[model samples]
Target: MSALRFAEDWNEADLSAVHAVLVRSYWCEGIPRETLARAMRGSLNFLLHDAESGELAAYARVVSDRATFAYLCDVFVIESRRGEGLGRRLMERVVAHPDLQGLRRFSLVTRDAHGLYAKFGFTPLAAPDRGMEIVRPGLYLQSTSERAGT
Candidate 1:
């Protein structure tokens, strides 16, 4: 195996590799290919690729204005490649990227991977605070139908 590689930006060529990693590692149930394609175009994504094979191993993204705060999302590593520190390496870049330094807070929502995220200084929202989503009923239903078709 080769040392891990990191890329701060991704292009069209990298999307399929990244989608495969996300699907295999995350079991990302309902996300559309178009959505992933759009996210890859965001300016603040951090991507880690396998150095020797150029396969995407893990990815973390931040949505920021280059000030104030940032949200970290979609952090994952391929199952066959876990326990090798690629997730940590990907997060180190996400947390320490020049544009993200000195943020007031960085946050994420995870259903189960709390232990993995905690190592990078992420913690649950304190009492009196909670995460909430304003679901768009139409979009939610549409995505559900699309996912069922897949």
Candidate 2:
């Protein structure tokens, strides 16, 4: 395994890689390329690169106000690169990012990654009773359908 390098800088190539991966994701499938670009521009991004192949091995980002709240989203290690601890490395770097530190709260929504997040001290909300959301399931899919009039 070649040593992985982490970077905060990104380029159009990186954005393309991110879109390729995210388009296959359950949460982001059907999301428009421009939407992804816009979101990336608004967030603090962390990318993991394969030193040997120069590939974008993993990525995560936080949309935060840099004061009181941070929402961790768009986290993924490409399928070919999973199960080698890259995800853990990504989360470690994300939580320790200077701009993300000292925030009053950090949150993420994961359908099946509780174990990974838990290793970084994330847990089911202590007050699950206090948490609420107005979820729009299949939002991207709905938009796609509407646009196609299907």
Candidate 3:
């Protein structure tokens, strides 16, 4: 974590830097800038920066009520910074965050990185049959078009 800085304030992060990184992420491809800005406004965002360069190096956000539940999402590390272990440090800060502890449920969805998350106690849904969702993959593609009036 040398030469790294961590921040939670929305005003401290560059909105365009975040949007640019996210639009390239597998999970958030084509996500609109305004949509992301709105989501950040409502969520608890964790950001890592290069202290020397002032660049956004990694990020993760959690949608929580500061109570019994939290949905961890949008976890990403800038590609140029991937091998530096920023991802692990980001999760370390998230799971240990004061508001996220002792919850009955702290959850996330990851197409990969299971091993990293498992080290922090995330697991396969104990009851896959018990969990359900109204997943709408690529649901944002239409929105992008609509916003463009295409």
Candidate 4:
């Protein structure tokens, strides 16, 4: 296995590779590239890649005000590269990012992988009753043309 490198710079992103993984992911299945691109632009992104090959191996994003609130999402390690601790490495970077410090709340939604986040002090909301969201299931079920607003 080749060594992996971590990068927080969006300038080093291989967006096509990231898109391929995300569109196939259970959470973002069929997500439009345009939408993903916009979301990436609006958030702070973390990336991991093969130091030698330069292929994107993992990714995660955080939407934050850098002061009091943040939402972590779209985290994943490529299926072929699982068991290499890449996800944990990415999370370590996310957790230690200077821009994410001192937040009153840092939250994430994960259908699975609770164990991973647990290692980073992420826990269930202390008050689920106080949390609310207008979730639109299947919001990403759109064709390229529609998703791109063409």
TM agreement with the true structure for every prediction: 0.79, 0.91, 0.91, 0.91
Native-vs-model 2 lDDT?
A: 0.90
**lDDT for every model?**
0.73, 0.90, 0.88, 0.88
Question: Comparing 2 and 4 by lDDT, which wins?
Answer: 2
lDDT of 3 by residue, 1-150 (tens): 559999998662478889888887778788888899999999999999999998999989999998999999999888889889999999999999999988999999999899989989999899889988887666567665664668
What are the per-model numbers of colliding residue pairs? 0, 0, 0, 0
Superposed model 3: Cα runs more than 4 Å off: 143-150
Residue 27, candidate 3: alpha-carbon lDDT? 82
Worst 10 residues of 2 by lDDT: 136-145
Off by over 4 Å in 1: 23-28, 128-131, 136-150
List candidate 2 stretches off by more than 4 Å: 143-150
lDDT (Cα, 0-100) at 20 in candidate 2:
94
lDDT of 1 by residue, 3-112 (tens): 77788768876777667666444335445667777766774888788888888778777777778888777677777788888877887787778998888877787888
lDDT of 1: 0.73
Location of the lowest summed lDDT over 10 successive residues in candidate 4: 6-15
